[model samples]
Target: MFLLIRISQQLINGLSIGSIYALIAIGYSLIYSILMFSNFAHSSFLLMGAYTGFYILILLSSSFPLSLLIAMLGSGILAVLIEKIAYKPIRDRGNPTLYFIIASMGISIFFENFIICTIGPRFRSYPRIMQTTFVELGKLNISVMDIYAAVVAIAFLLMLSYLIEKTKVGIAIRAASFDLEVVGLMGVNTNMLISIVFLIAGILAGLAGEFLGVKYTVYPQLGYITNKAYIAAVFGGLGNLKGAVLGSILLGLLEALITGFLSSAMRDIFVFCLLILVLLIKPSGLMGIQKQDKV
Candidate 1:
């Protein structure tokens, strides 16, 4: 009974954390599908999201839901600005992917340094808006915040899925993911689609950041931890949204099990090892479809 309870507890913890990873990974996959490059600056968006939520809660009110909404909108606008200022010009000039990479890195570094200089390097905790209550099921206890995060994440993901699957804009996004040029040739405005993608990605990043802040604490370097989300993105397949979600949940569960049964110090080593093994075995990822060059 004790062992079962422990396992259940770990599972709950894993799902809670995994939901955040999944959110971030979805954003990563979305951008990677269209841009064909990793946005290292994504962490900066998460940082902004966390700070936005923090200030909204502090200055405006302690309403968790309201703070989350504002954070998402604020981050979405910020992402649009980033795309316009940093990526749009290079993209319009038809620069190489390396340029995009360098620009992304520069943005990431600038935001990290900027936060450190302006916001200070100290960690800040969210006000206790939500009660740290627990729900009991049989012999297992689950945290209220964990349940809230997981449920909200799941709901948002479902909405995103619906948008992608059922909407006209979603169809354009899907087609663009396969081939942006082809999609544009088919009379689709690629720029508008890209903006929509960034907006969605930014919103997800904001939610993930706020949830992470609630679970842990907000700090300037907190976004650095999204390296785990990047790994999750790779594990799921760089361009596959569903795969990102699945991979994140699996990775989260794996981490939870390791932390529960072994030393926390070994968790990261195991994670990287798993990533290496996955790459070696399937470079295209579990659900990733590989394309071939035409002869």
Candidate 2:
């Protein structure tokens, strides 16, 4: 019975963290779907969101909802600015995809360094907004924060799903994902659509950042967590939102179980090994469809 309880606890913990990963991976996948390039700068948006929320909480006395909204809005505006200032020029010039990738890397590096230089590279904890409390259920003790995180993550994901699957903009986004050039020719404002995609992606990343900041310390390096999310995105299939969520949950569960039973040291090793195994066995990812090269 004790062992069962331990296992259940780890499972719940895994789900909570996995839900966070899903948030980040979904945003990453959304941008990839429309742009056909990995936005390494996405991590910077996460960093920006974290810092923004941290400052808001510190200054505003733990107004969680206000901080969340402001962080999301700030990050969304930053994303739009990035698109217009950097990516749009590249897009207009009809440069190769490599240029976009390099530009994103540059932007990411700039943000990281900018934060380190200005913020002094020290970790800061968020003020206690939610109590460190636990809920007991059937001999299993679960963290309230964990439960809250999972619930919030699911709620945001559902809203995203509804926006994508039900709205007209979503239909256009789906069409753009298939063939961006064709969509532009079809009278959709491709620029506006792309901006909206970036905005949504940034907003989600910001929310994830706030959750992470509350769960752990806020630091410039906090964005590094997005690496795992990137792996989850690839593991589930890049550009596939459903696959991203599945991959994130599975990865979270694997990490939690491994940490509980084995050692924390083995957790990341196992994750990378799993990534290697997936790439070797199924390069197209578990849910990704293989595409043929145009001759």
Candidate 3:
């Protein structure tokens, strides 16, 4: 009975963390789907959201909903600006994928160092906004914050699904994902569509960032957690939303079980090893479809 309870607890914990990872991975996968490049600068957007939420909570006395909105809006605007100022020019020039990757790396590094230099590299704890109360079910105790995080994450993801599957803009985005050039030629505003994608991605990342800050501490390096999200994106299948979510949940579950049953120290090692195994065995990932290049 005790063992069963323990397993259930870990499953709940895993689902909570996995929801957060799903938020980040979904954003990353969305950008990859449209742009065909990994925006490593996504970490910068996450950092922006974290800091924005932190400052809002500090100054506004823990107005949680307001802080969440402002952080998401701020990050979304920043994403659009970055897309216009940095990435748009590169896309206009028809540069190689390597260039976009390098540029994203540079942007991520710049944000990290800029925050370190200006914000003093200090970690800030979020004020106690959430109740510390736990809801007990049977012999298992579940955290209220975990429930909150999971609910919020699911709500946003559902909204995103509605936008993508039910809206006209979503239709264009889907078309653009297939062949951006063709969509542009068909009179779609490719640039605007791309900007919308960035905005949505940034908004989701910001929400993830706020949750992460509340769960842990807010620091410039907080964005490093997105690395795991990236791995999850790849593990499930890049450019596949369902795949990203599934991969994140599985990864979170694996981590939780490992930490619960074994040592926390071995969790990361096992994660990387799993990644290696996946790459070796199925490079296309669980749900990714192989694409062929035309000669």
The per-prediction CA RMSD against the true structure, in angstroms, equals 1.3, 1.2, 1.2
Weakest lDDT window of 10 consecutive positions for candidate 2: 285-294
Q: Which is the leading candidate under lDDT?
A: 3
Could you tell me the TM-score of candidate 2?
Answer: 0.97
| Shift in Å, residue 245, candidate 1 | 0.2
Candidate 1 backbone clash number: 0
Off by over 4 Å in 3: none
Candidate 3 weakest lDDT stretch, 10 residues: 285-294
TM-score of 1: 0.97
- What alpha-carbon RMSD in Å does predicted model 3 have with respect to the real structure? 1.2
lDDT of each: 0.90, 0.90, 0.91
TM-scores, all candidates, are 0.97, 0.97, 0.97
At residue 133, what lDDT does model 2 achieve? Answer: 81
- To one decimal, what is the Cα RMSD in angstroms of model 2 from the true structure? 1.2
lDDT of 3 by residue, 1-295 (tens): 8899999999998898899999999988999999999899988889888899999989877689999999999889888998998999999999998988999999999999999999879889988866477899988888888889899999999999999999999999988888899999999999999999999999999999988988888898998988999999999999988889999999999999999999899999998999889988888777877778768
User: Which regions of candidate 1 deviate over 4 angstroms?
Assistant: none
Q: What local lDDT score does residue 96 receive in model 1, on the 0 to 100 scale?
A: 95
